[model samples]
Target: MRDDGRAILTPPARGIAHILPRDHPQRLVLNDEVHARPSEILEAPLKLSYLAVFAEGEQRADVWRRVQELAGRYGVDPAPDTANHYSANFGPFRIKCERHTEFLRLVFIVEDGRQPESFEEPALQAVPPEWLAALPGQLITAANVLLQHSDGDWPEPERIATQFFDGNALVGASIADGAAFAFTDFRIRADGFSRLLVMDHGMTPRQAGRTVQRLLEIDTYRILALLALPMAHVLAPFLAARERELAEVTRLLVEAKAPDEALLFDRLTRLEAEMESEQSRNHYRFSASVAYEALVDSRITELREERLAGLQTFREFLERRFLPAMETCRSSAASQESLSQRLTRVTQLLSTRVDITREAQTQDVLASMDRRAKLQLRLQETVEGLSIAAITYYIVGLVGYLAKGGSRAGLPIEVDLVMAASIPFVLVLTALALRHHRRKAARES
Candidate 1:
């Protein structure tokens, strides 16, 4: 038997052969995930006080501790740390606690509501005020729900509204395919709590529970979804300022000189940094809002809502009021993303232009260096020719002096012929040695 009261059927072989493969590490946990937060069986004439609080990260540990302490007071074992849902009957009232990704939801249910009107007494009255006060997190959404029995018909819309919602216009529906009728003005009254009334027609306890969960969830997700609206409003002007600046920067890029291009690129880089920072700050918020809105839509669909007479349905009400704000948020997110991409594109284009200008300057400098090298080579060749002539002239003079001396000594030598012949040899040897030295140096370099 399961905790949900369903019978577990046994297979023919209670234990499979030992040859079977081992199960995945997370198989059992994953299999039980779908049943993590099963709806509580609820009956008519009940009052519920629901709270959705903005508590995330370290705050969640505090929340779990508070719930644990409260459970201990009632002699009930708290759920394990790995669990995200907890429910317990604490004698006076039943409490359900769920830890969501960014929020904590707690609902107190009491089956002893005797109020002729719904808001006269809420289920939270049964909770200890001190414990309630000590509960961590900022309250983001709070509502009181009255589940009362109905025969085949319900009271008139005007009467119901006047009695419970202080004459506000009502938004309601024949929900659960006519299994129940639900009504609310979606107004936070003087008590700082919105209201909902569900009149069960032929619903079993489980159906009643599912209906209440849906209603509560619709309220929760919708409010969380609207959390991004203010951010969108704040971002509107910021985005406009950035957009104008981006346009100016882009305009400057068109005709910027080399130095100016670098300056503009610097500015673009700064703008990109600012955009990325803004994205990091608001990306999670806007995306979470979108997801919450989708969940809101899904819950509304599960209600199978049909309009009641002389009132707007929940879907209609949300479309008229809530969805426009959502659209505003969506538009803001899109605009920011678009602006960021444009900023990146412009920055990249400017960077390319700057790089190209610097590269062209480098090429021009290299070309000038090449011209200088050519001139230096020509001068070096002329210097080599002069050096060879100077060496040959000196050597030939020395030989001529020796030959003249030899001729005076009566040797049969011709001074003029000897000197002339020696000129070509000296010139050839000097040129060849210079060429060899140049080739060796070039190879080493």
Candidate 2:
């Protein structure tokens, strides 16, 4: 039965392989992603120092060049410019460097058998001081971690925490189901460096390396996430003022007449511009903070932490201390978005009011023009009536004089009777002639 099952699966697998005509361009890269940053093999009693720098543009190139310069001292070729991660040994100490989207992380490790009386002896002490000082970009985080074997001659967590962390309340946990125990007070000492102490209970070299890496990462990401807190604090009063200004603008828009609308619109435009600028300036920081917070939580979960007596666990400390600051950032971002949306609506309303006022004014001007045109038409009609009457009177007088002259020449007619009788006729004829002339003129025009 097993043979038959294998045979059936094999045929389909072969058929499926032939089905793809060509390989995808990114197939290899995608497949290799899981193995990108393989865990290092680390024995116990090691000291590691880590640094993260926020970098951009020429600063990034500067960091790459600086690494190359350091590599030359050890006779090793530099990592390629496109490489996101690199690791190499330089006789005295080994370094692992990784490039992130907005920052670069450098880890210096001193392997086992280099035990000092104090864990405060930093692993970074082995690197060239001048070279370390010359690193590019502003420092985002710095920490030293000491990993020790826990089989024998190990002090209690209390004594270790007191000696290394200056008696601060320690957060300790047994992670990986008791494979290792971790302790940190999460405080920066007077030396300006934080400490993490990892006790290898029974973890193999690979597990130990990963464990140490996770511990360091937790600290790194925690600080990064809190970077948004200060930005939120600064923006709080600013946002409140903006909100009040927006409310005032809205009220003005409601009470606004036509002239006031222009001013209201301008105010709305300026407010919107300010909000957009704020969003543009702080968008990346807020988003990056959220991403870093998620990483912190993920690393904490991977620790699979169980609490120790008289101490808080990693999860407990983060939940109590870190989550509230993230919430503040989120609330501030929401408020900004809401304010912007309200401003947009108010601007639209004000614009509509302005358009309606313009339309009303246009209608009034048209009505006034209609009344003037009517008055002009009435004046033209009166002048035409006077012209008709004057032209008729002159023609009638001329006809009366011609009639008198004709009678005196040779006719048995009385001039008085003729003139008197012809008066009505002349009036009628003059009117007809004037009417005909006016009709002809109208046709021609």
- lDDT of every model, 2 decimals: 0.90, 0.83
Local accuracy of candidate 2 as per-residue lDDT tens digits, 1-445? 3755654335556578767778889999999888886666788888888888888988987897898889998999889988878899887888888887778889898975965446657899999999988987988778888887786543477787678777777888889888888988888767667888888888999999888888888988988888888999988998999999999988777777787887888888999899999999998889889999999999999999987878789999989989999999988888888888888888888888888998999899999898998898688768756765666566556766777788778766766676567667756776677679878989999
User: For model 1, how does the per-residue alpha-carbon lDDT over 1-445 read when each residue is reduced to its tens digit?
Assistant: 9999999987557466455788889999999989988888998878999999889888998998998999998888986887899999998999999989999889999986453355788999998899989988888889999998885766589988788888889999998988899999888877788999999888999999988999999999998999999999999999999999999998887778887986897888889999999999999999999999999999999999987778899999999999999999999999999999999899889878978998999999999999999999999999988988888889889989999999999999999998998889888998899899999999999
Supply candidate 1's per-residue lDDT for 17.
Answer: 48
Which stretches in model 2 have alpha-carbon errors above 4 Å?
1-19, 112-117, 152-155, 376-445
Tell me the lDDT of model 1 at 203.
93
How far out, in Å, is residue 111 in model 2? 1.2
Please, what is the TM-score per model? Answer: 0.93, 0.82
Q: Which consecutive 10 residues in model 2 have the weakest lDDT in total?
A: 3-12
Q: What is the C-alpha RMSD of each candidate to the true structure, in Å?
A: 5.9, 5.7
- Model 1 deviation from the true structure expressed as Cα RMSD, one decimal place: 5.9
Candidate 1 off by > 4 Å: 1-12, 113-116, 404-417, 440-445
